[model samples]
Target: MDASTVPGILDQAHRRTTAGLLMLVTFIAFEAMAVGTAMPTAVAELDGLAWYGWPFSAFLVASVVGMVVGGDAGDRRGPRVALPWGVAAFAAGLLVAGLAGGMAVFVAGRALQGLGAGVMVVLLYVIAGQAYDSSLRPRLFGAISAAWVLPALVGPVLAGLVTTHASWRLVFLGLLPLIVLGALLVLSAGRSLTAPDSPPPPARGRRWWAVLAGLGIAALQYAGQRLDLPAVPVAVVGAAALVAGLRPLLPRGTARVARGLPAVVASRGLLAGAFFGMDALIPLLLTSVHGYSPTAAGLPLTAGAVGWALASQLQGRFARVPRERLLRLGFVLLAVGLAATVLAAVPALGGWPAYLTWAVAGLGMGFGMPSVGVLLLEQSPEHRRGADSAALQIADVTLSALSIGLAGVLVAAATQGLLGLPAAVAASIAVCTALALLGARLAGRAAAPPRAAVPGAGTTLAAS
Candidate 1:
């Protein structure tokens, strides 16, 4: 390619492609935020109180499977094949859920949606890796983070309005057409994008390992949610399954957080687990302890999103900063923010502190998440990018599910009078804080070794 022909993300050469990718992310973000707001009403109307958790759990578990499949397909073929199918599945799921008359049907639809979302996300990473040059990635990722800001601010409100004035089903149904448009944009761009032909065969039997890994993650999440029952035995079995299934799917040394790529991936899981766990609990804390209304309790979430977008912009602007340093700083901020949020459990502190504290945690996420994405691209070879992206996302979703489940158990115990509400909240906060701190420690190891080769770029993987 001629130097003059190389185009930036915003240039005419790439504008349509960038718009399409951003639109996809925006819609997904809206669905996630909107569904959370509408879920209580949806469940109540369906009279599915007993199965209230399954909608989310099913989506998360199915996503793991989608990630593995997408990774394999993208590596074997290309995003062109995987992406369109994912979009179709996602749209189908939306229609199913929107039209469903029962919670069981709704949960199944959510599982399908999760599968589609998982595949789409992994493919997006692959697309970004291939579509943009190294110089453009930070800006591209920043733009993607910016796409979340609008949804975070308005999705809940819009969903609430639609649910109250119209129907909860509209929330799901309304997104279908927009998703179709996004898919078209992606497919059009994919036609013009150049990608390597099918690579050498993948490791023999890897797909089976991927399947087992997905099942293990789902089983572990199920067991975590069932902690109220035979806690020890269920947890033990879940752990065993998770280990056996996860070991082969991840890069070597991921369990021990080896230097470079493995540590980067491990840090992503720890950061997401700690951050999202605390995020899920915030509204509960505000409503239960501070006596705020649902709408009012969600204000902090909006503020957090603002902080996240701002930090993401800052990180992109200062692209020369070492990604490892940014990740470390982000984790430290998250730990401090979570630690401060625990203080909100005190009656004397009042609810206002959360608006500020949680924003700090969001800022941390803003810094760390994009940095991790950049580092992953830096470390990965062309052929392995899809698989590595899958591993990164798997860690994120699995750890987040586990964290939320544990928090639920603690909250449940508190409701049952086994522990005080304050104690339960504090304990959950402590666990998340510890994870953040541990991630901070590991951030240093996330840096790629000096002179590491970019795979398929005609360089050897020799460390300086």
Candidate 2:
């Protein structure tokens, strides 16, 4: 169904469900942005540079496991059981990470935290898919997207200040209450939801063991970058691990250039990696070359956030159109943004361009990210929702690590060595742009014709 035909927000009937879902989404984004900002300081204090990747890695790996468990539990037992469990796990992780001391100890704490956060995140996706009717889905998601705007602006800087002054540990410890509150918000909606359990799922996809392998290999990839590990070994190990992990999780034809649900999932990873990999470099660039404070480096991302929010609202209007076309458009914008940032290498235009370029990338990203999200939800089976959601996150982080890790090499070569910082960043941006454009084409191929229209897909926008 065409999204343009849906009812706008004020005209809609279901206000409570939308409120709960949006609240959940906003909280998640808030937590994620806050954590990203604070971690650098936390790492410095703990002197855990060697294991720095683990904190984020822990969340991601555990989230993969949680996706499967939560999806299964939601499908068989219902989101009621899954959602609360998710919140509990995420909070537990936060509490532990906050209290941890020393690098090794902190890494352990992060691992536990990630496991719980993973499950909770999947449950949230299932909740979003299940609770809101079709017509409301897009706008609800858009609002969630909008919620991220300010957080991007403020989250990093605040995290920087907190780490620099009060306590980095406070960031995690503080989030504990918010996690509990978010869980309660969902729980309060009704009698706790519960789906009937079914027979056990077969191990044909990226199930229990495979998830560990995927994450392990991803960790190794990060290790490669951190320690100057050789590329051959890193690629060999990472490839082997990913192949093992993807054996069951992805739909057929996913690894190759292609179309369909599986392809959509894979493309999401590429796009995510391209953006995140490049994004990781942005702060480093601002701090090192631009001579901006950490908080100042974060400001450019805020512009991206603004662009991200504005573009999200327009997606429902484009929903009925071909998915690939939209995907391609998003990539084009990203490439353009990257191109602008690349110009930072040139001395005459360096200063202001640093801040302005990302706005373009942000806008392009805003257009593309939600489209993929709606597609993932649309394709998920009630039973597979958890797995799909988990897969989506896993793909995002895994690729992000690859992109970011690789950027370290390029940026270092350009800045640390002889090529020069601006030139190095330009090279880095160029690589990301190339990958993003390629991913855009893949998204195009993957964009299949929608199935028969839903009764209310048109009405989804009625509330806008």
Q: Pick the candidate with the highest TM-score.
A: 1
TM-score of 1: 0.91
lDDT of each: 0.81, 0.67
Q: Candidate 2: lDDT of 187? A: 71
lDDT of 1 by residue, 111-160 (tens): 88988888888888889888887777887887887786779899989999
TM-score of each: 0.91, 0.85
Residue-level lDDT of model 2, residues 193-284, one tens digit each, is 54634523543344555475556656556655643446657667766776676555555555674445666667777777777777777777
**TM-score of the candidate numbered 2?**
0.85
- The per-prediction tally of clashing pairs is 0, 27
